[model samples]
Target: MTFETDHLGFLLNPLDWQPAWAEQSAEQLDIALEAQDLAIIESLRNFYFEFDLSPPMRPLVKHIKNNFGADIGNSIWLMQRYGESPARTLALLSGLPKPKNCL
Candidate 1:
C-alpha cells in the first residue's frame, strides 16, 4: 500500500514505523504493518462484542476453541493473520498499550 504524509507527502514502502502515528496512517497499512497499525487496537472491540471482556492469550485460545468447536487454529494464526499477540491484540482491541515485545 501507499501512504502519504504532509511531511513526506507520499510514502511507498517506507519502513521503520513509530507507534505515535497510528492515528493517521495505521488503517492504511496491510498485514505487513498490521501488528503495530493503529487499527490493531480496534480488533479487540470485535472480540469483546462476542466474548465480553478483553482476552488473554489463553482465553483467546479457549474462545476460539469454544466458538469454533475445534482446535484447528491457535495463537500463531492470530499473529500471522491478525498481526497480534493475545495481549497486544487485547490491548489493541481494548485501546491499551502496544506490546512491549513488539518490534
Candidate 2:
C-alpha cells in the first residue's frame, strides 16, 4: 500500500496525527518493528482506538503488574525499565516520542 502524501507532504493515517507535530523520536520506530518474536501491532491499535491517549509507562507498569502478574523490574532503574515496556513500544507505534524526561 502506498502512503500517499498530502499537499503539505504528510501521511494521513487513521491515528489522526500530523507529521509536523509528530512526537516520535524516529520515523521508523514501530512497536512491531522490533522483537520479531513478539508482534502486537493489532493490540496496540485496538488499545489506541479505545483510549484517546497512549498509556504511559507508569500506568502501564501498574496495569501489567496487576493484570499480567509481572513488574517492569525494580523501580531503582525506572527510566531504563519504563523505556523497555510495551507502553513505550505502543507509543512508538503511535508516532509518539519517549515520555518527556524518561531518561
Candidate 3:
C-alpha cells in the first residue's frame, strides 16, 4: 500500500497502478468509490492511453459524455461526485499524471 507518489499525490510511475491502489488513493482523499466512479476511472485510463496525457475538465467531461452519456458526464455531476476538481481527483485515482492545466 506504500507506493511512490508525487508531491501532488499522483502516482510517480503510472505503470505501477492497480485497481487496489486507486481504492487506497480514494480512501486517502475521503472518497468512497462507487461502481460508477470505477467506470469513470477506466474511461480516464483509456483516455490517457489514447492521448498520452490526462485530460483537463472540458475534455474529461466531453469524453465521459461520449462514453457514459450526458446525464452523468456534466460538470455538476462530476463536482458532486469528485469535488471541485474532478479532473485532478480522477487523474490521481486513475493513476495518471495530473492534467497540465488542472491547477
Cα-based TM-score, every candidate: 0.38, 0.39, 0.96
Tens-digit per-residue lDDT, 7-87, candidate 3 = 988898888999998999999899998998999999899889988989999999999999999998999999988999999
In Å, residue 2's CA in model 1 sits off its true spot by 21
Instruction: Please identify model 2 stretches exceeding 4 Å from their true place.
Output: 1-41, 71-89, 94-103
Lowest lDDT 10-residue stretch of candidate 1: 8-17
Model 3: worst 10 consecutive residues (lDDT sum): 1-10
* lDDT, each prediction: 0.46, 0.41, 0.92
The total number of steric clashes, by the backbone 3 Å criterion, in model 2 comes to 1
lDDT of 3: 0.92
- Model 2, span 5-57: residue lDDT tens: 34433334535543322323224433123342122334434555676545566
- Model 1 per-residue lDDT tens digits across residues 1-103: 3233323222222232235434334343343344433344444445655555556667656656555545423777656655655554344433433434543
Clashes of each: 2, 1, 0
TM-score, cand. 2 = 0.39
The number of clashing residue pairs in model 3 is 0
User: Which of the predicted structures, 1 or 3, would earn the higher TM-score when compared with the native?
Assistant: 3
